[model samples]
Target chain A: MITIDGVTKIRGRTRILHEVSFTARPGRVTGFLGPNGAGKTSTLRVLLGLDRPQAGTALIDGRRYADHDRPLTVAGALLDGSGAHRSRSARAHLRWVAASNGLPRARVEEVLDLVGLSADAGKRAGRFSLGMGRRLGLATALLGDPPVLILDEPVNGLDPAGIRWMRTFLRDSAATGRTVLLSSHLMGELAETADDVVIIDRGRVVAAGTLAEVVGEHATLEDAFLDRTASEGVSW
Target chain B: MTGPRRVAGAVHAEAIKLITLPSLALTVALTWALTALLGLTGRPGGVLVYTQVGFLVLGVLAATHEYQGGGQIRASLLAVPRRPLLAVAKIVALAGIAAPFALVAAVLAGRPGATGGLLLDLVLAAGVGMLVKHSVGATGLVLTAYEIVSPLVRTHLPEVARLPSSAWTAAVLLVAIAIFARREA
Candidate 1:
């Protein structure tokens, strides 16, 4: 389980996250929905221990991420890019991350197969297409088979078929009792995949609950998101 | 995994990263060519100065590669949240990669005993690169300080030259390590 309480972040004079709070329960996929400049990524960064929050705490399994002896084995994260150096081959890239966590070399091939990048494992990351890059990033996140998965915009460059595959993959991951928190602007995708939703706007949480609870009175999740965030003074 | 094993893993990962970079070959070739040219010119210190520039670039590349192409720094920090371990791993890996080339450069420059100095230059360059966070900017700053500022200072204050080169390198490296440990990725 991932718990964030009263998390606030200030970069320079501008506030990025304002006492943000949410919990991603185990055995569920939580959709972190927000607009372009919203605090979604910022919140994820703090949870991953990449960025420090000025106030409050983010905990995974009741312990700070940094405090975990085996952080990768506790929570695997997939952030913005592929996270592999451009010149490094996918195989080489995975090998190193696996080594970092003392994961077996077999895990490398397993993840590559899982992501459907087995054929191009020898190819440099810079040569991969956007969709391929996303796959590689996902493979890295699944390297340790961590119980909690945090992905930021996981489907940004995937095709329709790839997107559908990801939806099923995430659902299965959650069904296995893992905690999955993914942030995306695609409401239809989240509606199909996420069991819970947390919507934020202008650095604050506007609504958060189960899919049905938050979507009440609206024709769709997108419509409800538009209404909630629009009321928060966000134009378009 | 134990701390030592984790450190070893990080070093291995960093070494792989440094080797795969296309610029590494170019930088090594440049260093050798410059060393050879200076060796022929019969200016003993000139060879060290010129060849060290290439070593400095190696250091800069080692530090800034994490920030390249949308950044692998996030991935690195995620894999190993212990920043101090990560920083040390990088330094060790960079030094390992630079040792052979530094040795070759020293031989070509006719100051084979200066291999230690060349290694020190590599570490110092990497440290400055970490602080600056941009390869081009770090390279320019290091080059200016070494080629221009250091000479001017040495000419004005001869006593400054009495300080061991390792002391300055160690000081820069310590500051880099502190920043790496404290700063947010």
Candidate 2:
């Protein structure tokens, strides 16, 4: 489970997150929906302990992310890019991350196969196309088989087949009782995959609940998102 | 994993990263070739000092490589969140890779005692690289200070020149560590 309680982040004089609070429960796929620059990434960063917040806290499994002795085993995160050096082969990249958390070397190849990147394991990350890069990123996130997974823009460049594969993968991951929190601007994708939704706009939670509750009177999730965000009068 | 084991893993990872960089191979080969050429000609005077530029580039690249392209610094921090440990691991990795090269260059130049100075130069380069955060910018700054500014200072301010390079290197390294430890990745 992930709990973000009244987390506020200020970058310089501008506030990026204002009392942002939400929960991603286990055994469910929680879609973090927002337009660009809506603080989704910032909130995730704080949750991962990458950025310190000025108020409140973000916890995974009842403790701060940094407090975990083996953080990867507690929560695996995929944030922007492939997260590997451009010159590094996919295998070398995973090996290093696994080693950092004391995970066995074998897990590297396991995840490679899991993400269908085993054939491209030896290729330098810089050479991989966008879909390949996202797969590699997902492989890294699965290295520790943690109970929670957090990904930002996981389908930015995937083809239709890759997108379908990802949707099934995320659903299956949640079905197996892992807490999956993914942020995306793709409302259709969220409508298909998300069991719950947390919508934020202009650094604040506009609405959050199960798909039905949040979508209420709107004809679709996209319509609901447009209405909620447009109410704030901010251009996305 | 124990702290030592985690640190060891981080060091190994860092070492792999350094060796795989095309820049590392380029810098080392260039530095060695230049050093060999200067030694062969026996016109080694001040040229030997400039050879340290190669290793200095190596050091700078070592520190700034992760920031290149889309930047792997975020990935690195995610893998190992403890900033101090990550910084130590990087330093240990660079020292390990640089020490042998420094020794070999010193021997080739027939000034084995200068090995210490070369190592100090590597540390100084890495420190400046961390501060600057851009490989090209760090390289330019380090080379200018070492080749042009230091020479001018030594020529005009003898007392200042009397201060050991080791002291400056140490001070810079300390500042680098403090900045790295506190900075958000």
Candidate 3:
């Protein structure tokens, strides 16, 4: 379970996220939906301890990410894929990340296989296509086989086959009674994959519930999201 | 093994990454080839001197790529959130990669590699890599000083001029470690 309590963030003296809060429970794919600059990344950063929130806290399984002894084993995360070193091979990349969390060497290969990149595992990430890079990122996230997974924009540049593969993987991951939280702007994508939806606009929760509940009274999930966001206007 | 071994793994990862890239390999090869050419042409020990600073740019880029990319740093921070631990891992990794190169330089200099000074240089390189979050700018400046300023300083202030690259490397590594640990990942 991931608990985000009253999280507030300010970037460069301007408020980005104001008192934003939500809960992502296990056995469900909770989609963190927001427009660009709506504090989606900011909130993710706070949760991963990349940025300190001026107020509130983000907890994974009731403990902060940093507090966990082997964080990779408790919660696995992949925020962005472009951060990989262009020079390093995918195998080397996963090896070091695994070693950091004290995971065994075999697990690296295991996740590589899980992500269907075992053959290209020796290739450098710099040379990977966007779709392949996403696969590598997913492999890293699954390296520890952690009960919780957090992925932001996991399907951004994927092809149809890649999207289908990702949707299945995420669903199966959650079905195992693991907690999964994915963020995306595509409502239809979320509608198909996410069990629950936490919609945010202008850094605050506009609405959050099961996919069916938030999509009510609107023509579609997209219409519902647009209506809710449009009604709120824009704020710092 | 536990203390330095873990750090060694991180450093090994960085060093291996440094060698694996075709660009980095080209850079190092060019440095060595140019250094050898310079040595064979007229200048004595040019290869040794040039190669010493040549690879520093690659070292800096190793970490700079992480800082520039939003993901690697985040993944690294997530796995090892303790800033000092991560910093140490970098130091260990950089040093592990650097040790053999430094020894090769010493061999080219026709001197048995001395552990004390080379260890110091590795430490300094780590520090510089940390402080700059990658060393392109700093490496350029250092190389510039080595070529132009070091000679002038040596002629005028002989005492200051006597400082070895290895010593400066150690100092830089220490400063880099301090700066790296203090910052948020």
Question: Which one is best on DockQ?
Answer: 1
**Local error of candidate 1 at residue A24 (angstroms):** 0.8
- Give a tens-digit lDDT track for model 2, residues A82-197: 98888888888888788778889999999999999999999999999989988998898899899999999888899999999999999999999999999999999999999999
lDDT of 2 at A82: 90
Which stretches of model 1 miss by more than 4 angstroms?
A: B37-46
Q: What's the distance in Å from true for residue A101, model 3?
A: 2.2
Each prediction's DockQ against the real complex: 0.67, 0.54, 0.42
Candidate 3, residue A100: how far the Cα is off, in Å: 2.3
Could you give the interface RMSD of candidate 2 in angstroms?
1.7
Better of 2 and 3 by lDDT: 2
What tens-digit string does per-residue lDDT give for candidate 3 at A69-164?
A: 777888888777745666678898888777776678899899988888999988878899998888888888888889999999889999999999
How far off is residue A28 in model 2, in Å? 0.9
The residue pairs in collision within model 3 are B11-B93, B60-B135, B124-B169, B124-B170, B124-B173, B127-B173, B127-B176, B128-B172
